[model samples]
Target: MTRCLRRIAALALVLCPLAAAAPAAAQDSAAAEALFNRGLADMEAGRYETGCEAIAESHRIEPKLGALFTLAICESRSGRIAAAFTHFGEYLAQVDQLTPEQKSRQGERPKVARQEHDKLARLVPELSLALPPGAPAGTVVKRDGRVVDSAALGAGVPAEPGEHVVSTQAPGGPVWETRIQLAQGEKKRVELQVKDTSAPPAGGLSGRRAAMVVAGGVGAAGLVIGGITGALTLGKKSVVEEHCGSGIGVSDETACDQAGMDAADSASTTGLVSTIGFGVGLAGLGAAAVLYLTEPTQREPTAGATSRRIRAGVLAAGPQGVVLGASGVW
Candidate 1:
């Protein structure tokens, strides 16, 4: 009698948990079925948001292929292209795992899912994000609050069409956030930049002022060279006069000796150099004036400032002749 009682108690202990769980299981199944029916009704009535929510819950509880299909269709109709595409793929994969009889019972669902998936492929938007050239090694990027994989950087990755907030964080850098709106079939490329706030405070010469100084220095150097060369040219004329007869009407080349010819050549060379120096001096001074006039009144770093460029060029008519030297700041 004692052994019989012990065996009966053990059996009762084992069966009690099963009996208790049966009601919970039944309730869950009933709830899942109710949610599934309600989801289908809501979807039929064009209430995609509510329908998708209910159907997603039902699928979570019961994991039916039909519920997944309904959720996918609901998401697609609601313009959640990425979600729909993923669910359709999942539905198709699960359908593939079913028995042949079960598969046949799926009717045209597999075919329809494939078509929808392929079609969504073209309608889905992609976001291509890349860090700038000098981004820190441990930079972290997030899209809509989800961490993005490192390997996907600079590559076109799938994204849902809608307003999205992208954020990035780097060591010793401020958290950068950008708002982007994507449309169907649109591919956007974005470069993530980390703003450096570590620059020295505004206490030194501004970039434009510094540029003006440099240009002015160049102009001064050119002017000094022109003046020096001009003097040398006059000295060469005196040398030519001394070598050749200084009579006012002496125009014949044969009257002058080889020394005079050499002196004349030297004078021509000095004159060319002097002209070139003057041209350079004027161009540099003009560039300096432009830079000074265009400079901002406040002393600020050039970072993030409006982009400006200075161009300088020498137009040469021949090897020894520079026709024009031009400079501009724009």
Candidate 2:
């Protein structure tokens, strides 16, 4: 019994390392696979920051070609095209050991890399238009008093390296203006403030008095016509009632009929004239209100400026639309 006990003790001692190592190894493999999957999920969702973190963790645990390839893709999608190309090249250097299917997948990488490279090549010297918070979308962007493409609001737009005036305007707002200087391969952001000039000036009388006078005249004319029409209608009703009273019969109706016809014609003409006058008056009043409301409260043109630039070969954040950066001479 003592001999049997000694043998069992020895066996336990010998197997202890394998028993402990098995669980640790399994945990590490599982963690690595989980991180890798999360990285792919992030890349697919366009959450590049999370994707980068996950891919980096997966690479740290196990250096695999697939992980590196995914990392490259994540970098490219995150606007780090140069780094993506480098990592893709590194993946290709290890392509010899891959199976036929893996080689086929690997073969497609270069083509994708090349396309990204081309896109990057065309994406230098971008200009960014910074908009104030709550600025209306679809506002017109202008430069040097001329309209420029509003497409830059999406992302960075390629522009020549130089100084330029930038401005934006919307309906019922004052024009916003600023100046910025751009360097070769530099990405510059220009913030524009949209002004609101849709209020009338104070002091009860200024700038819009003439329009108001005209509108008042038109309104008064309408009221007078309406009053005249109402009076005429009342008179016609009285005359008709008098002539068509209880004792008047159809055979005794010649003068009554003539009087009734004249009254009817007068009432119809007055009603038509009143309606035209009222419609014209309402239109004039509306036009006057629009003119008064949209008049500029203050004529002073105020401007403020702030700018940021990113050179080519550098990564930068941009609002949606075109992506641009300055490139070094290749």
Candidate 3:
């Protein structure tokens, strides 16, 4: 019984690595096969983007000529000539001889892919990114989120004709980045540069100055509304006075009474609207003043920067029931 136990322990020890690796290996194989099947299905359905992504991911999981060829075909169908050309060339670069079964499945496809790739090279756009003489060492380049190696940088990198985001950074150094648009068959070179955040803000006002501008706008809008509502209130009051003024010289006293009551109700509504507008306008102008005072004094207005930028001015409306007013800057 002791010898039997000892043999079991030895077997466990001998198989430890295999036991640890089995789950991961199984997972990878299953994922690769699923992606490959999905890619083939999507390509057959003419879903170029989805098919390309699945095939590319399958190849990443386990490199295969069939996956690479499918990816190239999808890219071509999607109008990504540059990417298709590169992938097709890469597929042809695999010099390993295929088995009779494999060759039968993909007969003449290899020749056709290579022929299309050569023709595409002349018609595709490329982006050449070069660092200046003083770029910090250990600076790595990236396109979108993927690493672009030094070998790819020597010759221009082939890409789809559109906007591409390029980034570069060195260890402990600030990252430099930019976006460039490539036209079909155009070879464009871009030199990346770092951002300078130390300088004061540009283009438009910043901090409280910006707030002041916005507050001024709000104040102006409030003033306009207040004015309209104030006019309505006055018109309603005039209407009430005309129809029934002490019931003197008004024919049909009962009709005058009804008209007066209706006008009074309308006047009440307009009065409320006017009061709200005037209050909002006042608050907006007050906010503009506060924003102007609290603005950063350190930022001296750069050249061509206007100080007032049309600061808040006055707009007054008649009383809703009591006193009413609106102040603003145009």
Clashing pairs for model 3 are 313-328, 315-326
> Relative to the unseen true structure, what is the C-alpha lDDT of residue 321 in candidate 2, on a scale of 0 to 100?
16
- Candidate 3 lDDT tens digits, 144-163: 87888867764677878887
Better of 2 and 3 by lDDT: 3
Q: Give the winner by TM-score: 2 or 3.
A: 3
> What is the lDDT for 148 in model 2?
71
CA lDDT, every model vs. true structure: 0.80, 0.66, 0.73
Q: TM-scores for all candidates?
A: 0.57, 0.31, 0.49
Please list the Cα RMSD from the true structure of every candidate, rounded to 1 decimal place: 11.4, 20.4, 15.3
The digit string of per-residue lDDT tens for model 2 on 1-330 reads 999999999999989989999999888878989999998898898899999789978987878777887887898778665466567667766775678787787657656655664565454467667667787766788865777775556476655556778777877565767677766567766566685555453444544676666766775776677677767777777776666533256655434666676776776777666666555555555556655655444222223422222222113222221222343221
Consecutive 10-residue window with the lowest summed lDDT within model 2:
313-322
